[model samples]
Each structure stands twice: as structure tokens, then as C-alpha cells.
Target: MPVTSVEKDLNTLSMTIVADFASPLQRLWDAYADPRQISKFWGPVEWPATFVRHDMATGGRSHYYMTGPNGERSDGYWEFTAVNAPHSFEVNDGFANEDGTPNDMMPSMKMKFEFEETANGSRMTNTATFGSVEQLQQLIEMGMEEGTRSAMSQIDAVLEDLATFAAGKGTELQILSDTQVRITRVIRGTAPQVWDAHNEPELMKRWLLGPDGWTMPVCEVAQEPGEQYRQEWENTKTKERFGFEGELLESAAPYRSVTTEKMIGMEGPSTQNELTFTPVDGGTLLTLVITYPDVATRDMVLATGMTDGMETSYLRLENEVLASAE
Candidate 1:
């Protein structure tokens, strides 16, 4: 168990947990920074977590849910108040509704996580401040302390599993649920460079083409929130064309963007795509969470070899667009 100590102060209306890890500072930090690794241990062993949106920056928000053994789910949200990279971060944590909004009936708490280099490896101090002593007592009675202990106990496994989430793994896909999926890849470039490749029309046209035979003839990029963008591709030999159009719902430059996407002529519900970029050890970690309208729609889309096509485009982005810039 990595948890060294747990403290609760009624006078201060706070609880603090300190945990030490054998992994290096960056490794410990990455375990939390990367959603793939964090999702493995954020919740207790019995109630595993699935993060749909994790933006680890100031003014950002994260939406995740824990699934119980019997298919029950408890949603949560984190509003990041401060982020100092590998050192520390603070968030307002609270229960969330299915629609990713805060639940006002449930009490929210402020949490600060501080990381530091220890003699053997690293240490993380987590402090949660409740609004009132009654709130603190209520959470304690609800097994918050025990739950946190169990959650932190599982982190050791995630921290040591370096090979699984490391760079060069190519594009990886995780079916988060029936209606949501997460796609992640580590591109060989900085976050800004990767974000530019995604937003700049010229750069996107060069590398966003999924396969070798496809040419992006029309690339109308959206520069801000509420703006609609269109993308079309044509086969080189057959000239067969298809396109997608969407409105940018949210934009956090160089870090995150959320857009609603749909086939140009299709008459069905659209998908909300949330993209996040984080600077990692090797390069930039690009995570895209797509929320489908239903299980049937998700399955239909995955049947089209979407992940494989995405991998091809990512490889091209690294080699053809980013590498040439170097």
C-alpha cells in the first residue's frame, strides 16, 4: 500500500491523505495525467472508473463515472482551479448528473494534489476540504476514507505498467461504454504543433487524410466555438467523395476542443467529439472521446475500421507533417 497516512481535522473541515510511490516523479505524474492510466485506478477496485473527458489544465473540466459490479454508475466532475504541471493541481470535485452537470444536492469539495520528489521516488499529498464539518463527517460516514485508500492502493500497478501506455503504441481505442469510446495516440510533436496540425487547414489537409489513396479536397476548418466546419475526401482513382460537417461546441486552444460531428447527408443523431492534448515524456498525447447516439451507431461506426484508418493518419502526421518541420 502506498498510502503512508490519512488525517481528518474536524476543526479545519478537511481530510488529507499522503501516499508515496516507488516510481519516479514523472512516472507518478503521468499516471494521473494520462486518462488511460488514471482510469485504471481512480476509483476503487470494485468500482472502476471511465473518464470521458479529462482536461488537466487551469479552468478545465473532467467528467468521469465509476461503474459498480452490478452495472450501477456514479458520475463525477472536476473543475480544475489550478494546474502547475508535474508539481501540483487543485480542483473542485463533486458528484455529477448523467448529462455531465454538477449535482447541487450533493456537497462538493475542494481538493489539492501536491507532488514532490522523494528520496526513494515520489510522494503525493492529497487534501480535500469540505464546506462544513457536517459535510466532512457525512463523507467519512459514507466511507470516503476507505474508498480513497482502496483507490490509491491500485495505483502501484498502473505506475509500474509503463509499456502499456508508453509512446509508439500507435493509435489505441477503448470502448468506454455503449455510447462512448476513447481514442488515444502519442504523436511525435509538441502539443502546440499537434493542435496546429488539427486546426490549420493546410496542415490538416496534408496529414488528416486517412489513407494513401484519399485526398482531402475540401477542408474548411472551424477557428472558434459555434462555428461550423466541413471536411471532404475524394478517392484518387475512383473520385468517390464523402464528407462530414460539425459545429465546434467548445474550444480551449492548444489543449482541448469539443465538437458535434455528423455525416453531411445522413439523417440521424450526431456524435460529440472531445479532443485533449497533453505534453508527455516522448511527445504529445492526443485523446479523443466520441459520444455516439446509441450502441448501434457506435458499433456501426467501429465496423468501418475507424481506428485503423486513424492510425494511418497519425503516422502520416508524425512523418510527413511534423517530422518535415523539424
Candidate 2:
């Protein structure tokens, strides 16, 4: 998502971003919520930031300084308005001193970050409300839009690296070594988040086929061996349901999970999938390996345009996650 001052009201500037990455919503949220990952990419390349006092709470404060390009330097402090970790965060941005005194010279502003996951990807909204017309003008003069676009590009790089890195490692859930179709995907979410995405109807609707008139029902989940998960996809237009079931082949909460999924709509043997998640430096890296029985089915899936689809999806997810983190 290109960062444009897409919407502005009064003296406030607002922007919308979409990021889709292989990662699930939870891990993406954590990266944004954590102070460590945030300090890395918060500001521009010229304005490298360092966190001084980061107490992330409802009334907490985050005071950071940007080493100015010229002799001019500034320190900013954010007073938390709300801290809904992994979902939404809003703050009051005010220039402050090292001693916690607000700098009256700089205008006060209210900044908000909201995250939402959609079927195709995830979307983020950022709003910065300036104190006066002068402050808004200052931001425009600074070329905020271009600066934001550059920052977002860095975000895309991070997301792509995370996806490729996760896929390169991790254990196979289904373990179909000799299968012809090499259904390989790195799971990019925690075991619990993935489990919820696969289990909960509403959450699944957000990122799945809900908007497209596809219904997934008759779904079940087994936490242990022999535990079964059965789900059916019903085409709203045709009124046809393709029932699918998978045995809980492996399960590790907050870590990894795999299931053998079999669908009735598609012919041939059941497609087995193993979803793996490993905790990396800052967040979880996920890989999902899928194996189809015959070459025809594999060809069909490859022809379905999944590579592009997944790329777009993952990019959007990453963007949204990183945006909300800011």
C-alpha cells in the first residue's frame, strides 16, 4: 500500500495501508506492538530513533530522540491513550524534554493506529491530528507522503525476508516425502493463532472465502492424535457443500500444528498439509507444506494462480502489521 495522505479532515491527516505476508495476524501484531522491533523503522532513514523510556501501558510514555541531520535536534514523547496490544494503539504525540516536560514550541498532536484483517489481506489506518493549521502545513512541507512511502517499502522488505526465511526451515506436518506435488509453504503464525484461524468461523471469514459466498462449516478440531477436524465449504450460489475432514496428525500449542485435510469436491486422494511455526528472533516463522496425491491435482493448483495470490496476500499482511506497529 502506497502511503498517501489518502484522507484528511480539518487539520488532521489520515492514511490507509494494506500488507499481506505469510505470517498470521498474531505474530504480525506482536512485531508491531513490541518496542524492540518498532525502534528499528519508526522514522525516516535520516532520522534514526532510539527508545529512551518505553513503558507501553494505558498511561505509559515512549520518549525517543532523533539524531538530527543538522545541528537541530528534537525529542518526542508519546502518551498512550489506549494500548490494545496486537489490534489497536493510539497516542498523544508531544515534543517533550528529557525531564518529561512538554515542549510548548512544538505542536501537540493525536496519532492513532488501527489494524484490520480482510479476506484478500490486512488493512491499516493511521491518523495524525494536528493542533493547528500551522502544524498541518509543516507536515505537508516535510513531504510526509513520500517519506511514508519509503518507510513502507522497507516494511515490504522485512515481510518478504521473514516469509522466505520461515519456508526454508521447520518440520513437515504431513510428511509426504515421496509425493509428486511439492506443496510447500512456510506457516507464518503461532500455533494458537493458526488454530483459531482454522477453527473460528468469524476469524476465518475475514481472511478466507467468506466474502466470496463460501461457507466453511461442519468443522472440528482435535488437539491430540486421532483428534479430527472436519469442515465443509458451501457455495452460496450453487448451494453445494464440499465436506472436508482432517485428522489432527500433530498439535503443539503456540508452536506448531498439522492436519490431514481431505475434500469431497476435488477428486483423487486427500491432500495432506502440515503447518509448522518456529519462534524466531522477534516473532514466529511459519511454513505450511501441502502434498496432493496425483499430478493432475497438482497441476490444477499450480494453474490456480496461487503464487501471485499468496504474494499479494503476504505483502498486504506485512504492511498492515508494520503500519499498526508504528
- Which one wins on lDDT? 1
* Cα lDDT, all candidates: 0.93, 0.57
Off by over 4 Å in 1: none
Model 2 Cα lDDT, one tens digit per residue, 23-58: 455545545543334555565667755554454456
TM-score, structure 2 vs. true = 0.45
In angstroms, the error of model 2 at 123 is 1.9
lDDT per residue (tens digit) for residues 1-326 in model 1: 99999999888889999999999988888888899988999999889998888999899999899999999999999999999989999999999998789999988899999999999999999999999988888888888999998999899999988889879889998998899999999999998899999999999999998979999999998888999999999999999999999999999989999999999999988999999998878888999999999999999999999999999999999999999988
Worst 10 residues of 2 by lDDT: 171-180
Top-TM-score structure, candidate number: 1
